[model samples]
Target: MKKQTHTVLKNVFGYENFRPLQEEIINRTIDGKDSFVLMPTGGGKSICFQIPALVFDGITIVVSPLISLMKDQVQALKSNGIKADFFNSSISPQEENEVINRAIKGDLQLLYLSPEKLISVRNTWLKQLNIKLVAIDEAHCVSMWGHDFRPEYTQLKVFRNSLPQVPFMALTATADKSARKDIEEQLGLTNSKLFISSFDRKNLSIEVRGQVQKKKKLQEIVNFIERRKNESGIIYCLSRKNTEEVTSYLKAEGHSVAFYHAGMNHEEREKTQTDFINDDTKIIVATIAFGMGIDKSNVRFVIHYNLPKNLEGYYQEIGRAGRDGLPSETLLYYNMRDFVLYSQFADGGANSVMQKEKLNRMLQFAEAKSCRRKILLSYFGEHLTDNCGNCDVCENPPKDFEGTILTQKALSGIARMGQTDGITMLINVLRGSNNADIHTKQYFNLKTYGIGKDVSFFDWRDYVIQMANQGLIEIMYAESSALKITPIGWEVLKGDKTIRLTVPTSPSDKKKQQKVAKITTGNDTNKDLFTELKKIRYAISKEEKVPAYIIFNDKSLKLMASQLPVTENEFLAISGVGMNKMEKYGEEFMQVIRKFKSVSKPRKTPTTDKTFILYKEGLSATEIAEKRSLSITTIFSHLSQLYSEGKEVELEKYVTKEIVDKVRIAFNKLDRKVELKPIYEKLNEEVSYGEIRLSVTLILKNE
Candidate 1:
């Protein structure tokens, strides 16, 4: 079973190994057992069932919620030489009948349908076909506790009961523990194995910029887009009007961009999505209606122009970037206004309490002073032991001070106001604002009311937020977002316990925060070569009538440019390269590589070139190090550098796969830096530094 599954994975899907728990999940499903998989987006959830579908004699039916997702998945599958098709409203009745006939005739290996389509066809045409496995994509939609619940998914319980003989696998990218339990209950899975993959996407750097003026914020966004320069990105807005406004602003700023929202007609939305997916359009400013189940792997960044309603949606949306496992960026611009606006929207919902709580969590994440990734993962019930150095907080941590007096004053104001008002009112009271409400309530007469008049309203707001974050106060969302003092607040108010808070960063102070870090695509791949490969991919996409990623993602193209794979066997060794792809697209890509190599300059360092020569002359890196009287660490560094420069240095000769894996694991735990000292320390000094350097290079190459 393992060999067959591996063969399918390699020869068909072009992957060398199963991601964590993917093999286990596949084996469980093949054994006629139910399983639930909670993996992050771009975490290879589709492969879990795609492999089983290929291995099984009967067709595997996939229940997806989006027609775009089905079409994309089916196209990708067909490109890999897998027999797959979809039945959805997007297709004509004749086309649907053809798909149905193919399934009934045992010609199709996998079939995808929407939940509504599945429910409609289950008793009639679905039962006539042989079914081996039923995989539900976006399984979170089935649970009311989930962020994006759909009523059609609740009817799937009937389908589950009827297909008792078939194994069931429910998959989602973002589900908390409550949602997980709800899904299992809804699916009627008995003793099912549940797998929750790590929710951390280390390649994406998270940043939240707040309290900037609207004009400055728009300029900052323009500056951000300018820095990326031709990379694809998504700027998520909260409303259709915002999408249009952002789209027009970017267009006026001379960018190739478009807008997408629920308000757009079907054809308009489809064309916009297609243009973005095909790379004809570079930036997409859209509402949350975009990017669900989008398989575009080359998106380099994601920006949130407004605050998202919940952490799950925000995480899932940001997960859209860097899907190819290359370094990417996520920038969020939010303020107190976004919070209040979302709070008002959440106020009248059926799940108002839950909605407000989730919104509060989202606001906390935006206003957080610690690692943003840690907060996001913890919300999804995945805890990280160490601070992720990939967020703005980790990079530009705010300064802390003894803020006991400040916290006490703020808490005192809230308490004196009877804790009846929210953050705005509390700030007003603290800053001694002469607003009509304050004058009507005669709040200027109170002791706490004019005591903090020296502090600016913005500064007061920041201090209050810092206090809330520190648990010195709480916001009662159910009661019009009233401010309430916590047990810790009393201690701070009475000076029994001292509290430290981050100094409020004014707009001018934030301007001095370090400039955005340089975005790393990959290790020194030839940019010219990458560009040429994209051109070829775009041409092929136009010819083949599929998204460019279906031909080859940017990661695969980067590897091609780095490795300069000129032979069929060498091409197959590239990540995302399989026998089918190698046979189909090998000659064209290899020709490009060959031409570039022939014309490209060597651009070599003398010392590294000398080491490369000796290593190429059948000398191991260690042997060369000993022969040249150089340190092994220096020799390994030379080889890694040469590898990054497109030279084939057999890394396996210097380090065993197990050693490389251990070093890679340790390297991931730390911030992914080129320095080996941190990784060496993280591995407890068990692995040699030379091996760590070589292993890090290999990991980046494969990524």
Candidate 2:
């Protein structure tokens, strides 16, 4: 069964092996057991069930939350030669009937439907099919505590109960302990095998910027985008108005940008999403309504124009980027106003208390002085013993010094004032301000009143916020936003535990201190070759009417550029190339490589001493093509002729003895025709045409 799973992984999914926990989940599902998967976005959750869907004899029903997600996954699966379909309102009645009929006839392996459709139409068509498994995606949405709850998800239990014999798998990317428990209960899974993969996306470099003025913040975002020009990214705004404003600003600055919000018509929103997915737009300025289950894998960055409502939403949003496992970035700009607005909105909801608590945790994350990843994972019940060195805080940690006296002054002021005043009042009193409020309370006479007078107002505010984030002090939002000292704060005030606070830099100073690192394509990757490969991929995407990533992700193209595979076997060894893709695209891509190599530079003579010198200097064929202004095949030709002439050239070094033997045997095995293309095809195109040509020269010369 494991060998069969590996075979499916390679031949169908184009992957060499399963990602962590994927094989186990697939095996469990194939063995007719229920599973609860809590993996992160882009964590290959789809494969966990999709593989089982293929292995199962009966059709697998997948309950997806969003129509876009279903469509994207179905298209991707179809491209990989899997028979899949989706039944949703987005399709016409006739089309839906066609899909239903196909599923009933056992023509489809996987059928994706929304929870609403599954419950509303279960009796109409779903009951007629032989359903082997029921997989619920976005299972977190079933819980009221989830960040993106849907009432329709609550009705899924009825649909599951009707099909009690089928194994059920509930999967979500951003569920916490509470949401996980609720999902299992709501889905009615009994004694299910639980799988919780790590939430860490190491490719994402998380950074948070203290809110600057509007113009400065926009400029900072623009600067960040400019450094990663022509890459796909998302800019999440807190409101539709901000989305429009940011979209206009970026458009005026000559960026390929668009805006999306729930206020837009369905067609308009759909167009925006399609354009972004099709690579027609480079940036999307959107409210939280967008990006629920977007599957675009090449998004290089996700920028939060304002702080999110909670850590779950923030994590899910950032997870959209770097899905291809390439290095990406996430930048968040946060201020107290965002928190206040979020709190006010939460007040109107039934789950106000939980929402406010989640909001505060998000604020703590944004204002954290230590490693941001630690605070984030800790919320999801994962502990990281070491700091993730990828985040901004980890890369440029603030200098900490003994601030025991500073914290004591703030804590003392709060205590003396009965802890009823907010951060502003405490800061004003500690700074010894002659404000009207302070004088009205006659707080100037207090000993702790002027204790922190040496600290500036902004510095005092920053320090207090830091204290709240560090849990030494708690902010009572329900009590008119007052600050109360915690047990830790009491210890600090009593000189029991020393407090070390990071030195606060003013907003202007911090903005000036911003540093942008240069983004490189990869150390060993050939940029020129990579660009050429991208051109081929884009051309194929255009011809096939699919997204470029559906053809091959950037990671696969990078490997191709690095490895310079010119044969079918070599191409298969590159990641993401399955037998289907190899058969469909192998010849075309190899043609491009052969053309690039053969005519990259026309040879004036058959052999050249300079070529050997450059080769001996360890310059690869591609590198020598650029340095000597010769085609890669021309260089190979010169080396091959030199070897034939019994010169100092080492034939085995240029082409491995193993490959040389295979190519010679392949060429000699074919009779009456010694052509490179025929020999290439006969050998399954595993050996490059260039290698075949070189081998033929040597064979004829030796004979």
Best by TM-score: 1
Q: Please write out the lDDT profile of model 2 over residues 1-703, one tens digit for every residue.
A: 7866775777677787688999999988888889999999899999999888877888999999899989888988988778999998899989988998899899999999988789888888777899999999999899987888899999888887887778899999888778888888888897898999999998888888774569989988887777678999999999999999999999988999999999999999999998898888989999988988589889989999999988999999999998999888888998777887788788898888898888878887888878999999998889999999877777777888988888888888999999898888888888788889888998998888877888887688788888987789887766878888899989999999998889874333233224323344544326777788888888888888777888888888888766666755557667888656776787787776666667554444323667777888988878876897644545666777667767766655567767777877777678725455557657864675457757777677767
Segments of candidate 2 deviating more than 4 angstroms? 404-458, 470-474, 479-499, 505-520, 523-525, 598-703
What's the true lDDT of residue 488 in model 2? 90
Least accurate 10 contiguous residues by lDDT in model 1: 507-516
TM-score for all predictions?
A: 0.80, 0.79
State, as a TM-score between 0 and 1, how close model 2 is to the true structure. 0.79
